[model samples]
Target chain A: MSAPLRVAVDRDACCGSGNCVRTAPEVFDQDDADGLVVLRQAEPPESEYDAVREAAYNCPAAAIEVTEP
Target chain B: MSDTLATNVPTYPFGNAGLEPLLPDLGADGVGRVQLPTGQQAWLFTRHEHLRELLRSADFSSDFTRPGFPLIRPIPEDMPRRPDGSLIRMDPPEHTKFRRMLTPEFMIKHIRTLEPLIRQTVVVALESMRAGGQPADLVEHFALPVPSMVICHLLGVPYADHDYFQERSRILLAWSSPPEQVRDAIEEMRDYLTRLIAARRDEPGEDLISRLAAERVATGEMTEEELVGLSVLLLIAGHETTSNMIGLSTLVLLKHPEQLRQLRERPELIDDTVEELLRYLTIVRTGLTRVAVTDTEVGGHRIAAGEGVIALLSAANRDADVFPDGEEFDLHRGSHQHMAFGFGIHQCIGQPLARAELRIALSEMITRLPGLALAVAPDDVRYRDAVVFGVQRLPVTW
Candidate 1:
């Protein structure tokens, strides 16, 4: 089995609409002015895997990633 | 037909087939005319120089107030997009006002702020593709989302609602889609935006939607209906056109390995490469249709008052005077004043943003994936049969 998953993001396309941070603030963050995403923790705990992937798939730009590394 | 191409005018879908390359030959005859399958007669003007002239011309009108003007559909009575008219679909006095306020936002300097954000989107989308580890529809996986996301943030619309709008946009824009269904989609979109406006009014924010609502634009300056129309225009114009460019540019570069090699070797050529791609693709298709406000002669052909001409931007970019051998995709060509974004006061306001998005996306692809080639044959990939120009599905694998 692989180790637990973590979140990575495509910062370019985030648009900073704040949906990801709204859904799972533990995994995502955004710049105050631009509202573009800034990863709070690049590799969150395994418990957060589902939330991270949901955010990735849900991203308007599809600019989110759930990484396992 | 305009009695000009009577002998050989291919109708509708077939008319589109031969249109991609006539950019140089804005016909000397009258603005070539065609009867769309819908029974709508729209004029086609092929050539870059004339497109520029008409865009800035006083005689050319953007007002659809007159009968038989070629707006895709009428604004529903319930949601009057413009009591008078929206800026984009209007002539000077109004068009100039909207651009004066909005142009600064899209100029190259201000738009550059979004680059870092764009690159982030690119990296994430690419990572997902790499992880999925399968041949994927690049259009859906990457091309479509980037601009929508970017525009959503720019407008302050909830990026969360991207899928909802994207689906509605697809329905509204699909070629074979029934006119009624497309109109229905527009209505649905208007309804959703109406609600968003209400919410923004209650809670003002920095997003584009909120700015309009908070500004109380309807209080003698501009109406809420016009604001909604502007939002829709920005969303559709900002995303769809840019998406097609991305897909088409990728397809062309993949087909011409030599050009790709040249770019990979000289990374600095990416900016010019992107401009060349825009000039080459001219993907927006027919220039925004304009009616003749007064009798005028364009390219020595008389356009009678009340008649609108579809200034064929694609054809204009190909004019031999404007561009030599315009058919050839020459990245090194120093052709700057290209009408890819349009001309005059009515020129495309979102060009700076569009250019930024494409330059980043294309250059990054070249620099990162040196061996990238299409997973499937170009012939198999589907180009949309849009009255508007676009690729339907571009499936690619590296």
Candidate 2:
């Protein structure tokens, strides 16, 4: 089986557009206080892989990072 | 690849006659030099990949005062240019400071909290239009008022004064408005916002302007002048862009009855429908303008430090490689990657709010007004000659 996906977010670089949260709510969320990305799951399940990738791809600020095994 | 020579460059802010503006041939690389109405020559990138690179690059500056900034219209010579806290026209770390201050206010979660307010506003607009009977101007009755009232409520601006601000905003946005008129409009908007800011400072309320006045301005985190500029930007941008999108999206949907039927059948598709409509109608027809602060190579073209570049978002949204059969409107086409709200740091900050408004407004329109149809012939419809693409009036009946 493939290794679990790795995800990271840079709050400083996050313009807080929240595309990540919308695209992959299971893996990501917006901080209620600041609206920056809050990494809910650093290693999400296989089912969330596609959505996680799309989130990284579509993020306007390029603040989301994903690593696949 | 052919290079568009300076002598033969096409004029931009292309005409709005067709569903999509006819873009001039920009050679194999999808990059060309075009002539602005100001008589300035700027590099135009039409391809999706090229726009992503150009917009995301930190070497480009959004400051209009910069030498070689691609100005779509000529500014009056005597008008003093001070774009203080106009976040769209600013570059980091200044842009960051202002954007961060307001990010929490517009995040999806915060916008979700405003859904009740948006729905109420939408319902009120629909009912009001219905009260006027059939064959009403949908634009004047529904499209303009919903966003105007919502934004005014959020900013503590009086909706009764919408005619005044809306008229000035029209002049500010119209390409045909003379440079002097544009200058006067800006002054008038600034003067009005200045008074509003002063009022908020003295008597704080539960609104954005009051909050900013009490917190940021009072704490010296931002200045009153900066607040005035920011308020002016939000006030104008809040209503105009979304208003145009609502009007145009309705027209597009009414024309595509099949898709409209699908949306009505599956209300769950409202989210995807909103995305597709935004992608298809990339309303900022003039495109986002920026000037290079450092030499950069984009799409194999060497752009010098002082050169201006225009990211044609409309062209990029319809790039064939990204969206197969991009020309056709498909409600099922997952279009999250489209640059309708633009890209990178300067991406539309009000997008989440815009999305909520569009989803509620369009869904309500289709559901409530079952027999909605254009009262005038399709050919008789008039388009606005403005920075934003929209119908001058949408005469409709249910």
Candidate 3:
């Protein structure tokens, strides 16, 4: 099986458009106070791989980063 | 490149002859130079990839005062400088500072909390429309007031003053409004917000204005003038765009009964329906404007420093590459990548709230008013000739 996916987010670059949270709620979230990306799971399961990829792709601020190990 | 006059440019906003908003023919590359009404020439990027590249690039500046910044309408010579906290017209790091302060208030989690309020607003508006008798203009009865009341409640502004503020917002947005009138509207709006901010300062409430006033302004993180500018931006933007969307979305649904029937049958498709509507009716027809801060290449086209560019969002949304048969609306197509709320740091902060409002409003309207139908012929429905494309009045009967 392929290595599990890893995800990261840069709060500084996040404009809080919430596209990431909406796209991959299992892997990403928005901080309640500041509204920046709050990565919930750095290593998401195979089921969430597509959503994580989409979140990174559509992030307006280019804040979400994903790595396949 | 030769100095092409861009002589074939259509009017500021290309027409909406039918379902499709007309676009200037930007040949195969989907990029062309166009002349603005201000007699200035700017590059217009119509392709989705080009727009994504242009909007997300750091080389572009959103500041209107920058030389070569594309201005669709003339600004009065004595008009006040760009407002201190008008986020759309600002470039980072100034834009970043203000956006960060406001982001939390509009985040998806936060906006979700406002859904109950939005639903109630939608329900009351629908009932009020029915009570007003059939053939009521939905724009005035349901579309305009729902967003207006919600925004007013959030901002600590009185909904009773909507007529006062809404009229000024209309003049401010109208492309045909005289420069003097636009200037007057700006000054009047600022004056109104100034007083409201002062009141919020004195008696803090559970509202956004109160929190910002007590926290940011009082703490010196932001100025009172900045707060006024910010409030003005939210007050106008918070209502106008969504109101227009609600009005136009209804008309589009009425036009497409098959899709409407599908939505009615499966309310779970509300999210998809809203996204499709936003993409198909990319209403900010004037397009997002920016100036190149430095030399850059977008989609292989060289853009020199100080050159202006207009990202034709409506055209980009319909680009066939990103969206297959994009001209046709298909509700099931997941359209999250659509730039309806724009892209990059300057992407709309209130989009989550807008989406919530749209989802709740459309679903409730469809469910509550099953008989909703346009009262007039499709051609007779008047469209707004403003920066935001929408119907001026949608007379509907249920």
Candidate 4:
């Protein structure tokens, strides 16, 4: 089996546009308080890797980071 | 220069005047005060770093009703404040709530699926332009209709209503429009959207309003009134800004034939070229407005609560610190860092759609009109005196 994807977010840089959550809700979410990203699964299952990568690349604020760890 | 910014907010199309020279007068610290058309003094942020930070700050709010929120022009005191859920003027969870519901529709991947529709729309628009004969106005023929038709289709509004909506959009966005005229245009827009939403609720389609009606509104997650407001926001913003960019960017490229020739020769440069044009033009000439909800420090300057702040996107987009040789437009520069879409949570939800439209439309313009040249003298071209900077009409001939 392939390695799962690891996701992280720099909340400070997050402008709260929520592109991450929309792209990969299983791995990322918006904080209820201020709409910043909330990491749900640091390492999501292999099936979600495509979406996680898309989220990282498409984050308008460049707040999300993804790696295969 | 400072006097002009402080007393009489300067006219639109700041053009190559590119906010760089005015930085010193804005302040050594990159933050200072300037006056708005509302005849109110507000803080203006000029540097890129400071603008990015301020846009993301929770201490600043986009709420229109907030004291010290900068108004581009005055609104009547009797008018009701903008609806709570309008995308442009919301904060945090509220903004996030609305944005999340709409994000799936505008995601780059999803918008790419609409490329065929966008391409078809452009082809039809160009054909219509040709039918109008030579020495035609690009604004009416191509710039305005393509976006208007695309937006109408996306929103499920009738494309036949373009003249009606376009006229209303122009009046609403005009900087010097009388308050009563602005109010009437807004009312007409809201009423039109309200009717459209009601119709969509009864018989749904594949468009955004239909989707919202079936998913959000029917679920009680969003109210009908809020949906109507959101629809108004989309219809107006979707067409007005992109249409303006299409017109003005064409004018900019036509004026600089060398740059135009370069883009035509290197088709791969279109992506970078579009970004460069967005950065260079930075057409939202009114700047992003916000108010300090709490005391905050920006660029070493402490702003009190309730103080208005205007982040000069046009200035920051051209900041030498971020974009070297920032004043000049170079298509191959390949840098996409631009405040053309504003920033933060409220940063244009429709940006992906806008970018796709711009790339396709501009590329098609060059390929289809190889001999495209200005029909009018550069000085004779009329520029719209509006919040969104654009040419009023660009007469072009092959």
Candidate 5:
């Protein structure tokens, strides 16, 4: 079985490209005020691990980070 | 202080002659004062690090109406902004509010749904290009129409009106275009969009404009004037940037036949190649402008409050520190760090759609027309002297 995953976003570095939200809407969202990255779930269910990772990789600002297995 | 200002920077000749000369030489700090096409001087940030920092800072505003914003050309103070203005020209809350509503439309997954349609359009354009025979202009036949039709379809604007919008877009982006002509174009587009939005109100379709009307307009979350503005922004931006990238990227690849052959041989490389070409080309020379609302330090240079800042995206894209051997056009480098789409809150929102179009159009063009080659001498091919870098015409044969 896969271990739980963690998600974090450096809002300061977020480019508001919306790639993260698009890739993993379950785990990420854009702030209503500034469109910067907003983590919807710090530790989303294991089902979201792949999409969370994809968002981290595809983010133009490199703002999304995922850690632990 | 004015006497000490450096000579105004010229924004022409997209190759080395244009941005290269303006950029601070390598190993030097890359921030300095440079004049603009408006004859006003501002601090130009050339290094990648500096631009990234400035762009992310809230203090550096993207408000076009700001007193010190670096417009390529001056618009009259009384010239109106669309009710909500363009997302690129707004700061924080307002920009974010509008961007959130529009974000779903440009999402990669959403854009992918339209891939088949985009592909179909490309195939049709290519067939017509073939029927028109060799030595045909690719710009008119393929590059321009594919994205134009896609954007128009997305907006529910009639594709038949492409000639109208395309011409307006051309005048809007042309640096030499008079402000009066530019305003006239904007007024006409606003009128067109306003009428379209009103029609969509009664009987909406599945397209973006219809969705916007249903979700935002009916709810009073967005005003009609703002809807018109947003539609105009999407229409012009959707077609202009991608179309130019398509034309210029094709011209670049055709000029490098060996590289084109590599792409044809490895179709999987299409995605990376598009990113690399976007980085390498870094077209759209002048639109990335901002104004500092408060005193700030960028690259150790103290920029005063209300000072304008122009981040020469092409220069930053090639900054050797970020993109090693950045000057070379190596597609396999696989770096998506380029500022081709600008960055931060105001980054090009239509990038996913643009990327899909490019990846499809370019790969399909090479694969379908194995014999494709330029009809004109490399040097004789004309480039547009507009804000977006593109070939005026690409006469090609296979």
Candidate 6:
């Protein structure tokens, strides 16, 4: 499995409230300049599996399209 | 389906558009226990009258931590709404205490004090646009700027950082925003607040943050996390919802040329008309989900203790029983206690602030640019679909 949870953001739809980045900092990074989410890693380390899942689930917009890689 | 929750099913929270005929389906005798594809049977509420009982009732709770909670999915083990358990995420007694600390700040009197300031800000934003020219992106020109500026001023945040803060607010709200983006924002913003708090501790300021840090919260009366959560919630809500309202309400007003004409003729109707727009738009989609404190009956079904309940505030507002012509957008209609600010103990604390901003923005447009109309066809305009109920771009002309 690449990353236990893979989350992709639809930048156009994001409001940059930063809940996902705070919940799963390892996987989700909000662009400080534009406030868009930037994937820090295409595939996160296995150790961060649970964190990624939490981030995806907590995403308010349900914008985090999660994948079990 | 590994991710059974994801499929051809409706992620559309308010799935159906033509709900006029479905009002009777939700009666005093209504009952619904649908089995989610996830194999969970959750009670559903879909009527107007009953929803009032459910929201204002002390029986239902917003605490999502309890067991057997009726939520389709958990609040993700990651984001603890209150890292230190803020009142916004808690139940009574403690919730009352925390709410009391902040409620006075939002009291009608305290909120009205900001109206003058709000009026000034709206004027500046509008004038800058009018002076610049006729064509403008309403979202950028009026909708986004006014709320962001007001929120920043209220929070003791330096206006210099408005761009960064606004940008962060945007991405964090993008549809399905990734965790990294949000986490980075939380940490960064928290750090900024920490520094701001330190400054207030040393010198104090005229904003809410200084008052909060100097008086009750920071003195061991409240934890650092609670303080952070409240500030962030206000910062987010203060601007996000109002910005959307400004944008959405503009569309609503412009759509019905007759109503817009009526409003232009009589600015006195702006307040009630704004409320009507709030109810009709219900733009702030449901992020506020509450868990059952104990076994409770609502919307004519039994929701067991610990089940999470998502209120369809907008749907509830449009209930035909509540509004004579619920779906119709009528500016002349009488008072409607719409759920735009939601119901319950956790109803939007910043609603007064949102309302004030809307009143100022809408009234200014009517008085200054009475000729305002959509520069592009309604369909051509874009909407930002995700965390907040708002349009992406609203191009307008006068």
Top candidate, metric lDDT: 2
Each candidate's DockQ score against the native complex? 0.01, 0.79, 0.89, 0.14, 0.24, 0.01
Model 6 misses residue B321 by how many Å? 0.6
Give a tens-digit lDDT track for model 6, residues B1-398: 12234333333233222212122233454434434433444445556666667766677776645554444332334653442434556776666556656655664446678999999999999999998887888899889889998888988888788787788787767655566677677667677777777788788889888888878665788776677777776787788889988988888888888988888788889878987988787775643456667777785577667665556666677766777787898877753457677655566667667877888889987788867878998878776655677788888888
Give a tens-digit lDDT track for model 3, residues A17-61: 889888889888888888888988899988999999998888888
- Per-residue CA lDDT of model 5 for B1-398, tens digit only, reads 33146654544222333322234443478766665556677777788888878776777988877777776676655667543657777787777678878766776667778999999999999999999888899999999999999998898999988888888989988877888888888889899889888889888987889998998989999888888888888999898888888888888898787888888888999988998999988886653788889887887888888888888888888888889998888888976667788877777888889989999999889988999888998887887878787878989998
Q: Candidate 3, after superposition: displacement of residue B49 in Å? A: 0.6
Sorted on lDDT, highest at the top, how do the candidates line up?
2, 3, 4, 5, 1, 6
In model 1, where do residues sit more than 4 Å from their true spots? A1-69, B1-31, B36-43, B71-85, B216-220
TM-score of each: 0.77, 0.98, 0.97, 0.85, 0.88, 0.76
lDDT of 4 by residue, B1-398 (tens): 12334544443223333222234354456666765557677777878889888886788988988877777678987777875558888877787678777766776556778999999999989978888899999998999999988989888999988878888988998867899899999889888888888899899998999999998999999998889889888998999999989998898888788988988988888888888888988888668889999888987788888888888888898888889998887887865567788877678878778988999999998999899999988888877777778888899997
Fnat per candidate: 0.00, 0.60, 0.92, 0.08, 0.20, 0.00
Candidate 6 accuracy as TM-score? 0.76
lDDT of 1 by residue, B36-65 (tens): 453455567765555655665678777776
Each candidate: what lDDT?
0.69, 0.90, 0.88, 0.80, 0.80, 0.68
In candidate 3 chain B, where is summed lDDT lowest over 10 consecutive residues? B1-10
Error of 5 at B2 (Å): 6.9
Q: B278-317, model 3: which lDDT tens digit per residue? A: 9999988878999999988999999889888889899889
- Model 3: residues >4 Å from true position, as ranges? B1-11, B15-18
What are the iRMS values of all candidates? 13.3, 0.7, 0.8, 6.2, 4.9, 14.0
Residue clash pairs of candidate 5? none
Model 2 DockQ, alpha carbons vs. true complex: 0.79
lDDT of 1 at A42: 80
Model 2: CA > 4 A from native? B1-5
